[model samples]
Target: MIAQKAGGEATLLPTPAILERLETKRAIEGDRTVSGVVQRARGAAAYLYSAGVADTSSVHVDSGYLTPDDMRSLVEKGAVGDVIGRYITAEGTIADPELDARTLGLGLDELRDAAMSILVIGGEAKHPIAHAIVQHGLCSVLVTDEHTARSLLDAAPDSTTSGEDPS
Candidate 1:
């Protein structure tokens, strides 16, 4: 909400928009200390916290100053994807119950409602995460390299994509 209000769209960046991928809690705080990006994100989180929408102590992110300790917590609960917001699984489940309760961002349902959601990601490590968001219908479109794209399709099971039965 704050990023969008401050001229940031919901489009995914090439890097991991999710915090854990950016930092390991001791890895120099990943992208938080970067020049211009942190300001907007921290500002956003601050506003949300002030508005009682988020808890700053939960703001353990180093990527955009708005991390709610997203990745590790969710990954432990079988989360495959960590989008810009919260943790979601390929089955469209919320991986981390604790983080989910305190986050001040859009829900998966809300993200799906955005006019357009383009996910930009790459790497073998990111395959599972990307798969969850795409499988869950959170992203309207994916913006990844051919290798990762093929990887996602190859990993797919014989099942419906949009809740429609193949039969």
Candidate 2:
């Protein structure tokens, strides 16, 4: 909803987990027949996000589309979290594009320039992500449950030193 505050409408979508589940179910029921759905949705989203980034006219965060393999690769590469398709590193910088094809939406500049950035995701697993976002000043406001808040605070946070790993 931070986008609304910035005079833009928030376009909410299913989390990457949900999309992954759907894709898995479809795979179970059919196989590659349903995989095209992710591609179609991703292509359309990429187009829309390209415009958003160009115009500096919109903001969005989506997950649940990245497959387990995709997320695992990122995690292995020191990614703490992802938003709007872009990976956030431990130091709060977007992951380097060299790691993989960058996702659409909210480049670091776009995110920093926003009047306000809000993060509503949480979980023990999400602690590092929240920490990176907070330390990096990526989000001005955060909406999370008490348990998640506590966990995030309890988990020692790390400062992002650079956008990419030396490797």
Candidate 3:
């Protein structure tokens, strides 16, 4: 809806209802070979391929939260957040490792194939994860506010921070 308002067409994926059905099927059957699962996966992969994602130069990923605390919470107390069974953390780390395979969406390999991986996140709560993303080169480009950018620069390694040579 927002993108449409801005003149960029939005491509919506499967509805939650349809996704739930596929999830249920996956939980019961364990493989995509089962009747409907294969078709849907192929359809989605085909859609992505047709959408120019295969070119690696046009695919842009805009989701995933960067909060190490969220990962810690899920690990320490089984506490779930925005990443419970839905979102993938930076660099394809699953917030809920227990539900790793059950994640029904684009594979990390496909995402890594993209020429530009932009991570747009900010604020104190997310600083740690954002820094981690930069340190690990999880995102090719970052879009964030000034305060967070300074924080990241301060936390960055001498070689990575501005005004320092990589040698």
Candidate 4:
């Protein structure tokens, strides 16, 4: 399932139409449950399942930036579930190679075989993260800006691999 953050304020983001489409397609093709990592999406899933709009499972993890107790509070308030805490080293930043990689890896490992694939989409902000996702073998697909796409293509060994910033 493709899980994307809704736009606007944290509380004002619109329901993701892509998710609805995927859910609908899966339902018409056969019984399938799409999984995602957002609280509102989870609530929507519950509603959709009840209304026969779609079938889905929602998994929520603690935000790595939040304190454990605070994150637990969110879970208690029904903002999230499956409170997996952050795994960090002494540096305070994410010790994992990349943010999305850590999230995807943890999701796949904790959820076991349920996680089939991961999709990362956005602009340049997601480029490095997408690279890490590919390196970690977490996501099979990546959606990015044209500039980032060209950069990736150029970075390939078969390409020229020249005229690029090494750092």
Candidates sorted on lDDT, descending: 1, 2, 3, 4
Residues 1-167, candidate 3: write the lDDT tens digits: 65468564445333221132445736645443443443454343221121111111212212222234434454353222222123334433545544445445444444344465666666666565566556654556677889989998787667745876677
lDDT of 2 by residue, 67-155 (tens): 45555566676776565556667786655464323243235655555665556765556666677766676666777778767876666
TM-score of 4: 0.32
In terms of lDDT, the best-performing candidate is 1
Runs with alpha carbons beyond 4 Å of true place in candidate 3: 5-7, 17-92, 160-167
Model 3 lDDT vs. the true structure?
A: 0.44
In model 4, the worst 10-residue window by lDDT is: 46-55
| TM-scores, each model vs. reference | 0.52, 0.51, 0.51, 0.32
Ranked by TM-score, the better of candidates 2 and 4 is 2
- Using TM-score as the measure, the top candidate is 1
lDDT of each residue in 38-134, candidate 4, tens digit only: 4333343111000000002222222123344533443343331221222222222233323223231133233222233434344554344434444
Q: List the residue pairs that clash in candidate 4.
A: none
Sort by TM-score, best first: 1, 3, 2, 4
* lDDT tens readout by residue for model 1, 1-167: 75588665542222332333323322433444442343343333222111001233323344353445534555556766555456566577776755554444345665567666666777766777677777777777677889889998888785786787978
Instruction: Provide the overall lDDT of each model, using Cα atoms, as 2-decimal numbers.
Output: 0.53, 0.50, 0.44, 0.33
The runs of at least 3 residues in candidate 2 whose Cα sits more than 4 Å from the true structure, single-residue gaps closed, are: 1-67, 99-101, 155-167
**What local lDDT does model 4 show for residue 65?**
35
